[model samples]
Structures are given as structure tokens and as C-alpha cells.
Target: MARPKILVVGAGFAGVECVRRLERELSASEAEIVLVTPFSYQLYLPLLPQVAAGVLTPQSVALSLRRSRRHRTRIIPGGAIGVDTAAKVCVIRDITGDTVAQRYDFLVLAPGSVTRTFDIPGLAEQGRGMKTLAEAVYIRDHVIAQLDLADASHDEAERASRLQFVVVGGGYAGTETAACLQRLTAGAVRRYPRLDPGEITWHLVDIAPRLMPELGERLGDVALGILRRRGIQVSLGVSVAEAGPEKVTLTDGRVLPCRTLIWTAGVAASPLVATLGTETARGRLVVRPDLTVPGVGGVFALGDAAAVPDLAKGGDAVCPPTAQHASRQGRRAAANVVAVLRGAPLRPYTHKDLGLVVDLGGKDAVSKPLGIELRGLPAQAVARGYHWSALRTNVAKIRVMTNWLLNAVAGDDFVRTGFLARRPATLRDAEFVDAYLTPEQVREHTASLRAGLDGPPTG
Candidate 1:
């Protein structure tokens, strides 16, 4: 008899963890594992702001899958476009635009998420995202280019517009992004003799009443204070009303002239979740406490794409979409898969909160570890130490540490790669929003494909 095929979608923290555990627990003769993802590496998302701020190189955070000890798992270099649940087939489009139907005895959906955006005007066209490696690199170069342009331009209005930078959202990503990039500009401006520190402005706006509410009130207050002391304008309970090529109007009726707008508001589950035609909460696939999709046999979901119930929170509390939760969920999902294969009982996924860390760049930081609040250099050390230890590979850790040391000693070069200068790196662009099929289209395509595979009706 052929071995059962386990197919996992995505190469993020969840997907990678699931595959790794499956490889370790199950022998090659027992099951065949396959991972489908567009990229060959699992991106360390939390450290992405450092890449954008020039504190770490892009490759330092991208851990390669080939380096895994589990060499038996096959990797398909593509994105899963659609899934035919009835037929147990996943439709994948490879990097070259070729399509293939991958059959799986068990399916794991962990496609992760894309940047979440509101219906605000001009956001789709004008805002740059910080979710992907390309976007981070693009942002760093773009910010440097702005400073260079402002320094050379004779028009004072144009210079001011170019110097003004705005970042939306005050969560971890948004906060770190604004803080790090603000530091970048602060240091880079010294290179421009014509540019004055007052001409450059960094504004961070969010719809929430406070920044990083998950960090607890005390730590959140510390984070806010640090950003303010660094000259970052923190606007709470507000958001961008309208964004344009040269200016953004805030909800408070303040029109700020800014050429750069970075959006880190939040993220939504991958559109592939909807293609499952299953129940979802807030656009995430609904799964049982064991991480299995209810009523969908041999199918599981985890990570940002799945709404895994938070057993620790009692009832109706689904786990928040975070790396810590996703990584643990992935392991539990894999264990359940193994249990089913071995005819053993499955276990529910549950975890305690490990606290939160917010790195505000430089010596300013805040963290609450094991309910103990910390700030300043101590928090900064803990934050960096946690990230360094969490990195999947030794090479990655070395590269990241070396980069940190070098950055502290030499500072940023403020060089623009010009790779994405002409290309739009908005949320839509990074997520490949155009490639996904509409709900109706997915239904039609799935039905049509199923019909073709099952053959014509009997006469």
C-alpha cells in the first residue's frame, strides 16, 4: 500500500514548524510530506522592521528550508491558487505560471496573511507595506531617496513634503517601523548639509486609543513615551482619512504634507481560506481545538489563516494571529496528524501567554516577560535576545548578531538599491491580490475541475 501523503501549504512559521515535526515523528516509509510555498525560506517576520531600518540584511532573517534536517519532505515552489475539497486536490500555480493538481491524503492549510487595509481613499495606491522582504528593502531605499531629493530640491514646499513621513498603525509592526525609520532619517539627515532636523517630521497614527495595548498599560505607556522622546508624533484614536501622492488628511481634519506613507495597520487571512468554502471567523478558517477543520476529514488549518480556539481563555476566544501561537499550533496540528496515522487519541492545542516585546530601535525598548515589566536598555536586551534565540538556524543568528554589531559601530550607509523604486510595493502588490479568484469564480472552477476529474454523468 502507498504511504499517506501529507500536504502543507505555506512556508511561514506555522507551515515550517508543522513540516519539521512531521518529518521528525513519522518515518519516510509511513508518510510522504510535501510543502507548497512561493518562497523557499521561512521569513522571520518580527525582525522585518530591522531590515527596513537597515539594522539587519534581508537574508539574515530569511531562514532557508533546504537546510532542514528533514530532507525527505518535497518542496513545491509555488502558491496554492485553489483547493477542491470534494476531490482532495489542491490547485497550485508555480513561479512560471504553470498549474498542477497536487493530490493529498491529508491537507494542512497555513497560507498565512496579507496586510489588512480599510476602505480609506488612496490607501491602495499610495501606501507601502512592510510585510515582505521586497517591501522592507523598498522602504529603506525609498526613505533614503526622499532625503536625497529633499536636499537637492530648491522648492521649500517640495522639500518639506519629501521630508515628512507618516506611518499608520501603532501595533508592534507599526510602532517599530516608525521608530526605526525615524532613527534612520535622524541619522541620514546629518549627511545632507542642506537639510535641517526640523524639516523632517515623523508622524505615527493609529485608530486605537493606545499603542501596543497587548503590552499592558504600563509597558504601552513606556513605549509611547520613548517614541515621543525620540520626536515621533504619536496620534492615538485617529487614522488617515485620505491619502494622496503628496499629502494625507488625518481623521482629525489635519492635512499633513507627506510623500511617504507606510501602512502596518494589521493583516487578514489569506484569500485561500475563503476558497475552502468552510466557516470562518473574521475571515479566518474555523478549526476545532485540535487544529482540525471541523467536518473536513483529514484537513487541518493553523497560523494566521485559522481561527484556533484559545482554550486558555475559556470559551469563544480564538487564538490571536501571532508567531508564538502559530508555531505552537503547527506542532499540535502535526501531532494530531501523527496520532490519526498511529490510531492514537489526539490532543487539544493550548498555550500560556509568554508576554510581549516592543523594540523601539536603539536603546529605547519595552517588554513584559512573565508579567514583569521592563524598559530601556534592559528591555532592549531581552527583546533582541528573544529574537536571536528564536531564529531557526545558527547562520541566521550569526548574521543577525554580526549585523547588529556592525550597525552599532558603523551605522547605516543610506544606500538605495533602486530595485523597487519604479515598481509599486503597496499591500496589494506584495500580496499579489490580482492572482486570487473571487468566491464565485472559485466555486465555478472547483465544480468544473471536479466534473472533469470524475468524468461525465452516466447515461
Candidate 2:
């Protein structure tokens, strides 16, 4: 029998888990598995705020897929541009600006997601996204820089603008970013004796009624209470209708001038999901209970990219795109694929909500696990322990824990790395966008500017 060719797109939680399972279930010569992504590392996105707050290093959250012991699978460093379902081929664009079409017998669409953006004026051009390691580093440096600028400025308006930080969306991402940064800023201000922590303002806005909608009512309220105690302005049923370089206009008819806007509204499935030419629910490919597309013979999908039924709810509802669901589904997708090869029965996808955890910096948290509610120090311990165990590598776990220990004993390193100027800090200008041109183009422009500024024809 000919060996089957399996192609998995993405290196996030789903793709990485699926690849590991495939390698374990199949023999070296039995099948060929290919993992395609823009980078060879899997990003632990949940701990991104810790990176931004200097509680963890950016590299600590990145796990290199190529270094794993799963030797049977080939790691392709590239992004899958377009999929030709009819031809069973994927158009891949690698890091070196080369494009190639590869064929597969079986395909797994798990490109994960991207930040969901809207048509709000100036948002696309001016807003910064907090989805990557670069963004986390930039935020860390930028926040410290803002404090320095504010302290040095004689103009009260400029100082006030520099100290104000606005965050959109009250979900896990936004809430965590705001809380962590607020704590960091408080610590950062002590170093700058000229600046006062009370002068800084952090605004968190959301259209939802609560801080964390996924964490249930009781826990959400507790989370909100914690933020309020920390002096974070938690505004519900509100949104930024317009965002400018200097300020944002809220839907409530309030205009706030601020230098920083950390956008974390939510995420949508990858644009590649739309190009798959399959039946999808809100951009997520619809899948059977066994996690396979009904009509596509050798196609399977899970994670944020697939709309798998939630049998645990006993209703016609789809499972949410959470890390909890994605991790389990990735394993199930691999099991079903292995079942097909070995002539065994496939199992349906189902899981009960294990509860939620919201870390509100400085030992304050809210959690509900197994239907039991927890708050304060207990919840904070549980939240940190959960994330530590969920990390992919022991090295990462140690590094993250070490940073936390050092931070508690000493304090945040307020010094900026000055790396922001060397690269594009915004999402649109970064390589995350599908615009043509390479990193070389970015470097060349910098060189041209330097040449022009050094006077005409130096003898």
C-alpha cells in the first residue's frame, strides 16, 4: 500500500497537538506528515501578558516544533496561502519568499485564528494588536517609555496623554493585559520619582455586560470587583467607535485622549479557513461528531477552525473556540485519523466545561473549577498552577516560574531594550499582513533614509 500524505496547517495549540499524536500513532515509514506554519515555534498565547509585564521572557513562551522528538513529521516553515481542494494541493509561501504547491491525500485545516478587526475609522491604520511575541515586547518597552516621556514633559496635556492607557474588550486577553500593565506601571513609577502612580489611568471597555463572559456570572462579577478595587475603569456596553493616533471616541459619546490603545476585542478564524471551500459556521469549518467534514473523504478539522458539536450541552450548539476545547479536539482528530488507518471505530468529540480562571494581577484572581467558586489568593494560585502545567515544555515551565520568582523578590526591569525602532511594531506593518515585499524591503528603506540624511555625496 502507498503511504498516505497528511498535511496540517498551523503551529498553535491544535496543530502542535495533532502533529505529536500523529507521530506517536504512526510508524516512521507508514505515512508522511507535514506541519506548515509561518514559524517553527508554537506560541503559548495565554502567558503573553506575563511577557508584557516582564514576569516572563518572550522566548520562554515559544516552543520550537522542529526540536521535538517527533522525527516522523516534517516541519515546513511557511504559511499556506490558498488551498485548491479540487486539486488536493496547497499553495505555500515560505520565509524565503518562495512559493510551492504541495499535494496531500489527507488534510487537516487548523490554521487557528487572527484578531477580529472592524471598519472603525483609523483603527486599521493606527491600532496596535497584541497577538505576537513582538507585540508583547513592544508593549513592555512602550509602556515604560510612556512613563519616561510623561515625567520629562513640562506640558500637562502631553503628560496626561502619555500616562493614559486604553484597552478594548473585557475578555481574558484585554482584562489580563490591563491588569498586568497596571501593576507593572505602578512598579515602574517608583523608579521614576518624578511620576506618580495615581496620575496613570487604565480604561477597559467592552460591549458585553461583564468582564469575562466565558467565566460564568458569579466569577465574572468577582473579576470585575477585583479590577474596580485596582482603580481600572471597567466600562460595559461601550466600545471605541473611532480611534485616532492620539485619542479614541467611545460609543457612549465620550472622547479620551491617550497615547496607548491595546486592542484585544476578539479573534476570528484564519482567512485560510475561508479559502478551503467547505461548509463553515461563522468561518469555522463544519464537522461531524467524529470531527470529519461530511463530504470531504480524507479531510478532518478541529480546534478554532472547526465547528464541532457540543454533545455535553445536549443541544444543537457548537463547541466554543477555547484552549480547553482546542487541546482536546487536537487529540481526537489524531485518534480518528489513526482509527481510519487501523480499521477501528472513531469516538465522538465531547467535553464538559472545566470552569474558568481570571488572573487580576498582584495575587488577585477569580476561579470556578468543578462547579466550586474560588477567589483571592487561592484562585491566583490555581490560575498560575494551571498555566504552568499546560505549557508544552519543562524548560518553559521553569523559565516562567523563575521569572515570576525573580519578579517577586526584586522588581520589573523598567529599562527598554530599544529594539522597537529596528523593526515594525504595529500589526499592519509587520509581516503578519499579507502585503508583498520582504523584511529586506523594511531594512532597505531604513538604509535609504540614513543615506539621504547624511548629506549629498560624501567625499
Candidate 3:
């Protein structure tokens, strides 16, 4: 008899964890595992800001999948374009544009998320994103290029626009991005004798009344103070009303001239969740406490794409989309999969919140570990230690630590790769806006595929 095939979509923290556990528990004769993802590595998202600041090399965060000891699992370098539940077939488009129909006895959906964007004019065309490794590197090179351009420009207004930088959203991503890249520019300015340190400005804007509201009231204030002390303009309760090639108009009726706009507002669940044709809460697929889809047999979802009920919190409370929750939920989802296969009782996922950490670059930071609020060097140490401990492999931990040490001793090398200099690295570009199917289209395509499999084409 052939082994049962288990297919997992995505290679993020959730999907990768699921695959690793399955590979460890199940024998090759019992089941065959397959992982589908566009990239060959699992990106360490939290350290992305450091990449933008050139503190860590890009390769440091992109942990390779080939390094895994689980040789039984077959890897497919592709993205799932559509899923037909009735046929139990997943349509995948590989990097080479070749399409394949993969059949599976069990399916795991963990396609992560894309940057949440609004309908603000010129935002999509002019704004840069920070979701992927490519985007981080692009932004770094782009920032350095701006500095080089500003030094050469004769017009004061043009130079001023080039020197100004704006980052939207005050969450972890936006806050760290502003803090790290601001430090990058602060140091890079000395290389350009013509550019004054005061000429370079960083503006952090968010619609929320406070920065990093998730960090709670006191720590949020602490983070705000650190950014303010670093000469960063923190604009709360306001957002960009409009964006142009060289200027952005704020909702508070202030127009600022700036060439760089890094948008980290938020993230929406991947469109793949909508393609599942299941019920959703706030754009995330609704999953049961065991991380399985309610009505879809043999299908499970987790991570940022699923609204898994937080059983620990009790009563309709869903888990927040964070790395800590995602990684834990991934393990739970895999265990439940094995339990179902063996007719064992399934366990519900329940985990308490593990506080939060924010590194504002340099010696300033804020964190609440085990319910204790900390700031300054102590907080920075805690933040780095937490991240270091959370890394999956020792190699990654060593590389990250080495990078930190080297950066501390020998300053940044403001070198530009110039990869994205000619092309626009907008949010849509990074997220592959055209890759997904709409909800209605998914239903229609699934129906058509099922019909085709049942009979011959009528036309």
C-alpha cells in the first residue's frame, strides 16, 4: 500500500514547524511529507530591521531548509495558486511558471501574510515595504543612494526632500525600522562632508494615539521617549492623507517633502485564506481550538492566516498573530494531525502571552518579560537575549551574535547593491498582488476543476 501523502503550504514559522515535527514522528512507510514555498529558507522576520541597517548580513536571517536533518520530506519550490477541496488537489505554480497538480490525503494551510495597505493615492506606487528580505535590502540601498544624491544636488529643496525620511506605522516593524535606519543615516552623513547631521530627519507616523500600544501604556511611553531623544519626529493620531513621488500630505493638514516612505502600517491574512471559501473573522480563517478548520476535513490552518481561538483566555478570545503564538500553534497543529491519523484524542492549544520586546537601536530599548517592565541597557540585553534564545539553530544564533559583535566594533559599511535602483519596490511588488484568486473566482475554479475530473470537457 502507498503511504499517505501530507502536503503543507508555505515555509514560514508555522508551516516549517509543522513539517519538521511530522518528519520526526512519522516513518517514511507511514506517510510522505511535502512542503511548498516560494523561497528555500525560513526568514527570521524580527531581525529584518537590522538587515536594513546593515548591522546583519541578509544571509544571516535566511536560514536554509536544506540544512534540516529531515531528509524524508520532499521540497517543492513554488507557491500554491489554488486549492480544490472536492478533488483534494492543490494547484501550484513553480518559480519557472510551470503548473502541477499535487494530491494529498491531509493538507496544512499556513500561507503567512502580506502588508496591509489602504487606498491612499500614490502609496502603492511610491511607498516601500519591509516584509521580505529583498525589501529590507532594497530599502537600505535606497536610503544610502538618497544620501549620495542629496550631496550632489544643487537645489536646496531637492536636497532637503532627499534627506528627509518618513516611516508609517508605529508597531514593532515601523518603530525598529525608523530607529535602525535613522542610526544608519546618522552615521553615513559623516562620510558626506557637504551634508549636515541636522539636515537628515526621520518622521514616524501612525494613526494610533500611542506608539506600540501592545507594549502597554508605560512601556509605550518609554519607547516614545527614546525615539524623541534620538531626534525622530513621532506623529501619533495622524496618517498620510496622500503621497507623491517627492512629498506626502498628512491627515493633520501638514505637507512634508520626502523621497523615502517606508510603509509598515500592518499585515492582512494571505489571500490564500479567502480562497479556502471558509468563514473568517477580521480577514482570517476561523479555526477550531485544535487548529483544524470547522467544516473542512483533513485541513488545518494556523499562524497569521487563521483565527485560532485562544483557549487559555477563554470565551471567544482568539490568538494574536505573533511569532511566539505562531510557532506554538504550529507544533500543536502537527501533533493534532498525528493524533487524528492514529485515532488518538486531540489536544487543544493553550498558551499565555509572553510579554513583548522593542529594540530602539543603540543602548535604548523596552521590554516586559514575565510581567516585569525594563528599559535602557538592561532592556536591550533582555531583548537581544530573547531573540537569540528563540532562534531555531545554533548556527543562526552564532551568526547573529557574531554580526552584533562585529558591528559594534567596526561601524557600518554604507555600500549600495543597486538591485532595486531602476525598478520600484512597492508593497504590491513584494507581495505578488497578481498571484492570488478572489473568493468567487476560487469557487468557480474549484467547481470547474472538479467537473473536469468527473467528465470530459463539453467545449
Candidate 4:
């Protein structure tokens, strides 16, 4: 008799929550849990815009896996490249670059989502994503650098182009990104007296009809109003049709010459989902209400990577790929895994939409908590409080709170650390392109530097 090996993929909201619950509920003698992920920390993605705006430190958003007491579970520092269900094995490439096939009695697939990119000419190579902590930090540095370049430039055209910031998509990520960056540039401009704050334009464009549409109609209008009041030009029913080295053609028959384009369009399933060689709905593994892949023994899927049904909403539709739903589903999936071992009844995944919060930078936010729409500081309080409460680790929560407190009295530091220049890895390469570095090298090196690694070698 052997302990059932429970292998969980991903370290995002879903996977981390699942692993945490399993550690608490399951006895060490009953099961052997293995948590596999590319990184050793779980990222609090909702507050990523705060990281981008230099409002909160980057490390504050990442919770360490080592800090969590897994009890019996082993944390594997690797990603599952392929899953062989029939063989009951997962092909994982460890930190040492060795590919090992480990057999598992049960598997939880929460590989998470990747940036949903399009073939919209030069997007894949040029554009940046707002998914990871490194990406957020890179954006902050990049924005500051742009302001510096704008102030230093003599040519009016070059200066204008440098100051122009275009953000694509009207979703939560895009909206928050635009808001944060807009505020960052406005504050950063004070350091550059030469640069006119009015000249620095922030344009937000989305193909959808409204911004923050997921937050219901009233909240969407509230979010739009906040952005407009902040002088952010919101263009709905529009998209960047084409983007060149220094220009972008909008779908609304408008050509905007700009240097910076922050693409926060949307997310697709991870490449790992395709590698599973199983049936998927729009790159997501279609899973049952129990969070298991139908007819696929020993395989379970959840999170943005899996198409789990929203039984609460009814009628054949899968749940939205959100942290709110994914976190709870993770707990249920863990319980079901234990249920199979103990001959207990499995629970069906169902959750009522608890509304959404859109942080519109500064103290402006729109929220709908328990179906009640709220705006301004009230929304902002709820938004920040919710994220702070949900943040996984105590260290992260404390750091985030401290950062916020400091930011309130003292404004953002516009200074660029020039940290990424020392490292070859980039937001476009590692975080966006899905390129995992081989054994010896790490994908995100400057991450350590941003995490309070003291000044360079005192030579």
C-alpha cells in the first residue's frame, strides 16, 4: 500500500489555494502532494497595476511557496511540459534541465493562462504584457525612461511620441494599467519641468463597447467617468489595427503616432494546455463540475487553463477565468481529490458572482459588492482591502500595507533603477514569449535586486 501521489500544476491563485487546503486538511500519512510550477511564489495579480505604477514594491505582490507549511507536500521547482494520462505520468523538466516522468495517482491541472496575443503585426515581438511581477516592474522602469527621454529630446515630434502612452483593451487589466500609468506619468512629470504634463497623453482603446464591462453596466460607466475626468481619452469600439516602429493605425480610421503601447488585451490558456494532447475549448481543458477532465482518468483541471462550468449561472457555460472563482474552485478540487481516496461524495463547483472592483488609480475606483454599485473612495477602500485580505502571505500583506502608507504621505519615486539593463532577460522575452530558461539560468534575475538586494558589489 502506497500513499496516493497528488500532483498539482501551477502556483497561481487556484493552484496555491489548492495546495494550501490540501496541506491543512489531508494527513501526511494519507497522501503525498507535489506542487509543480515555474516559479517558487504565487503572484497576487490584482494589484499588479500598483507594482507598475511604483505605488507598491514588486516583491510585495509575490508570496513565497517556502513560507507556507506544506507539511508532507514536496514543492517541485519545475513545470509540466506534457501529461501522459494513460501512463499516469507527467513529463517535468526540473531546474537542473533534466526531464523526469513522475507517476501520479491523481493530478490537478491549474497551469493558469498566458497573454492572449494576436497576429496584429509586430504585437508578439514588440508589445509588453502585464501578467507577472517582472513585467510590471519593467513597465514602471520603461514609463519613467520614456518620461526621461521626452524631457531630454529637442525635437518636438520625438518628444511628443515619447510622451504618448497607448493602452489596448478595456478589461480590468487594461483599465487599471492605463489608470496607474497615467497617474505615474503625471507625478513623474513634476521632476521634468521641461516636459509639459498636458503633452503627456494617455489613451485607452478597446474593441468592446464599454470599459470594465465585467463589473456590470453602472460600474462600467463609473470607471469610464473616472478615467475621462483624469484626462484619459477612452476610445470604445476601437482597436489598434496596425502598429509600426513609431505609429499605430486605429480601427476607427485614425492614425496615432506613438512610441509606447501597453497591450493588456486578454489572456488565453497556457501552452501547457495544448501540450496535454487532450480536447480543449478555446485552448482550455474542458472539465466536469467535479473539476476533472471527463473520461480522462487521473486528470483534473481548474483555473483559467481549464473550462470548468458555472453551474450557478446555469446552462452549459463554463466559469469565467477569474481569481474570485478560481480560488474557491481550487479548494473544492482538493476536497474531491481526497474524496476519491476516502469514498466520500464529491462536491459540484458553484459560486455566485460576488461583483468586481475596478481600481481607477489614486483614490478613484468602481466596485459592485453583493450586487450594490459603489464608486469613489468607498470603492477604492473595498478594492484595496479585498486584495490585501486575499494576498497569500503575511510578509506580502505587511509590505503592501507599508508601501501604501508610504505612498500616501510621500509620492511615487520616478527614478529608474536601471536594474533590467544589467540582466538580459526581458518582459517581451521571458514573461510573454513563454520561453523557460534551461537548467542553469533563471528567467527573472532582476527580481532578486528589486526584492531588497542591497546596492551593487562595494568595489
Q: Give each model's whole-structure lDDT.
A: 0.90, 0.81, 0.89, 0.82
lDDT of 3 at 353: 91
* Candidate 2: residue 271 lDDT (0-100): 68
**Candidate that would win on lDDT:** 1
The TM-score that candidate 2 achieves is 0.92
Residues 1-459, model 2: lDDT tens digits:
768888898888888888999999899777889988878788998889988988888888998776667656777778877665655666677889776666677888788877788889978765777888888888888888889889899888888888989999899999999999999998888888888788899999999877787777878888888888888999999998998877889999998878788889988777676666679898788999889987768788888878889999977799888888888888888888888878899899899978777777778888887777899999999889888999888888888899888888988768888868445476565426553233243333234333456332110
Alpha-carbon runs more than 4 Å astray in model 4: 422-428, 432-459
Ranking by lDDT: 1, 3, 4, 2
TM-scores for candidates 1 onward, in order: 0.97, 0.92, 0.97, 0.91
Q: For candidate 1, write residues 30-144 as lDDT tens digits.
A: 9999999989999999999999999999999999999976668899988988876777878787899876778788999999999999899999999999998989999999999
- Runs with alpha carbons beyond 4 Å of true place in candidate 2: 422-424, 429-459
Query: Which consecutive 10 residues in model 4 have the weakest lDDT in total?
Result: 438-447
CA lDDT, candidate 4, residue 219: 79
Residue-level lDDT tens digits of model 3 in 1-459: 878889999888898889888988888888889999999888989999999999999988988887877756788888888776766777777899876667787999999888999999999998999999999999999999999999999999999899999999999999999999999999899899999899999999999998998888999999998899889999999999999999999999999999999999999998888777779999999988888888878999999999999887899899988899988888888898899889999898899998888887789889999889999999999999998898887889999999999999998879999877899898887878678766566556556556776452211
lDDT of 2 at 132: 84
RMSD of 2: 8.7
Task: List pairs with backbone clashes in candidate 2.
Answer: none
Steric collisions counted per model: 0, 0, 0, 0
lDDT of 4 by residue, 1-459 (tens): 888889999999899889988998889888889988878889989999989999998889888888865545687887777665655656677777775556688999998987777778766655778898878887888788888888888998888788888999899999999999899998888888898888988999999988777787877887888899889999999988887767778888887768778888999887777755678898899888989898778788999999998999899888998999999999999989888889998888999978888887778988888888889999999988888898877898899999999998999768887757544333346553354332222213223323436432110
